[model samples]
Target: MERTLLIKNMVCDRCKTTVLELLKTEGFKVQSVALGEVVVKDASKKDDIRLKTALQAIGFELIQEEADVLVEKMKLALIKQMDKGDADFILSKIAEDLGKHYSFLSKTFSQLEGITLEKYLINLKIEKVKEYIQLKQLNFSEIAYSLNYKSSSHLAKQFKSITGMSMTAYKKLQESDRKGLDKIV
Candidate 1:
């Protein structure tokens, strides 16, 4: 039989690659490894413990509880939306996609993560904005639109609020400060 492993902190292509390599090196028949989960054949509780130990050594985690699984799912959904340039907090849409009631998801997310989904999303967006700024490809107006913000001014207000500096000031700064998606939460 196969077992599914829900993981936390697998947020990027590089992360997926790392997990895939680890599974192969550790002699697990990994059926698949995705952003936030892995399916492996012939897994057991002992395998879980060993995998957990190996992943933890590399700053990742094996999620064991249902609530934690849901939280990781929620994070994956938000990051996907952001990457697709469809960032929006449509509770109904998020709920429908996740197959849960909006209220329940919100409450459970808050209880498990100690922060509302909206707040978490805003933080993610701000981080993305920093990344875009450093890349220097898109203008502020373009980024604002890509992120689904109302306007460049709106994005600037949020950027300043989150980072304590103007967008132009940020651009001029010597340091290209940014954080990885997995490191966000």
Candidate 2:
């Protein structure tokens, strides 16, 4: 039998690769792995328990609730938007792609995650800004424009607000204070 499992904290391609390898190592006939989900063939009850234990050991989670799954999907959708540098597309993209209303998504994410969706998104973007700053390839203006901020100042304000320091200060202390994408929430 083929089984699909919804996972939490799968925020990037590396996460997919990690999960795929782990599933294979556990002797499941892995079918596919994507952010927040995986499919495996010939799984049994014992397999479920073993897989859960393995996943937890690596900072991943086996999500069971339908609402929790939806929240994870919303998080992945937002992460995709951030990767594409299309910051303003959150509302429409999530609504159309997930087939849910913005209000519903926002409410559900807040209720499940203990933070508003908007704050969660801001955290994601701030982390990206930190990454770009660490790379030192893009100036503040370019970074702000690429992430779709109104202006570098606007981006700076948000960055400082979220990170508790100005971009310049962050640049000075650039010793990898960045959080893993999965730890954003």
Candidate 3:
């Protein structure tokens, strides 16, 4: 039998790799590992207990509540939208993709996270801006376009507003200033 486990704090490819490796090393037949969930084969109750413990030991947690699961799903969806660089009707798109109403998702996200989903997304976008600036491959205009901002000026304004400093200033700062995606909220 296959069992699917909802995981928390899995926000990047490295996290996925870590979870997959841990599962394999712990003698579980891993079916797949995604950002927020994993599927394993023929796992008994003892295996699940061990798996939960192991995952928690490494900063990941098994999501037991359905509401938490939905929130995680929404977060993953928002991340995917950001990666796509198409912010047009993004909330609706996410709701459609997740098969949930936008109002419910928005409400649940704010209630559970104590922060509006839009605010969380803005934070994520700011972090992405920091990443792009650090890469030095794209100019301000390109970064703005890629991130769905109206213009470079707009992007710079939001960046400054969120970071308390200009983009150029942030670029001058150490890379350690950037926050991890999972740590955005």
Candidate 4:
């Protein structure tokens, strides 16, 4: 039977890779590893304990909840779509793809994570913008467009609101001085 495991702090591609490697080394048949989940083809209680320990050792915790797992999946999917720099996505599209009401998911996420889904998405987008700015490869307008902002001014306004500084000021600051998303909160 395939079992889905909830993992905390498993937020990025690197985490997915690490989890997959750990599972493989431990002899579990991992079907897939995503942002906050691991699908195993056949798993037992012993395997579960070992997997939990392995993940915990690397600063991740295994959770137990189908709803929570689905919530995490939703968050990850949104993040991935945003990261792709696609402008086609909106809340309704996400809700439809997840087969759940946007209001319900947003409410559940806010209640559980103490942050609205929109806020989380904004944070992720801002982080990506910061990365692009640091790279010095893309101009503000391009970054804004790539991120699906209505315009450069709109992106700047939102960026300033969130980071308390203009994009120009941020770009001038030393990269080493920049704060990460986790540090922002």
- At residue 125, give the lDDT of candidate 3: 89
Between candidates 3 and 4, name the one with more favorable TM-score: 3
Task: Give the Å error, residue 183, model 3.
Answer: 0.5
Top model number, lDDT: 1
How much does each candidate deviate from the true structure in C-alpha RMSD?
Answer: 1.3, 1.5, 1.7, 2.4
**Of candidates 4 and 2, the better by TM-score:** 2
lDDT score for residue 120 of model 2: 86
TM-score (all chains, Cα) for each model: 0.95, 0.93, 0.92, 0.86
Q: Which stretches of candidate 2 lie above 4 Å from their native place?
A: none
User: Ten-residue segment with the worst summed lDDT in candidate 3?
Assistant: 83-92
TM-score: the better of candidates 2 and 3? 2
Candidate 4 per-residue C-alpha lDDT over 1-185 given as tens digits, one digit per residue, 9 for 90 to 100: 99877787776788889888988898989888877788898897677788778888977778767667666766667766865667456866777888899898888888877888788778778888888898999999999989888899999999999889999999988753454433322
Using TM-score as the measure, the top candidate is 1
lDDT tens digits by residue: candidate 3, 51-145: 88999999998887888998898888777776776555477677888888989989999999999889898899899888889899998888988
lDDT of 4: 0.78
Model 2 TM-score on a 0 to 1 scale: 0.93
- Evaluated at residue 66, the lDDT of candidate 1 is 82
How far residue 121's Cα lies from its native spot in candidate 1, in Å, is 0.6
* Model 2 local distance difference test score: 0.87
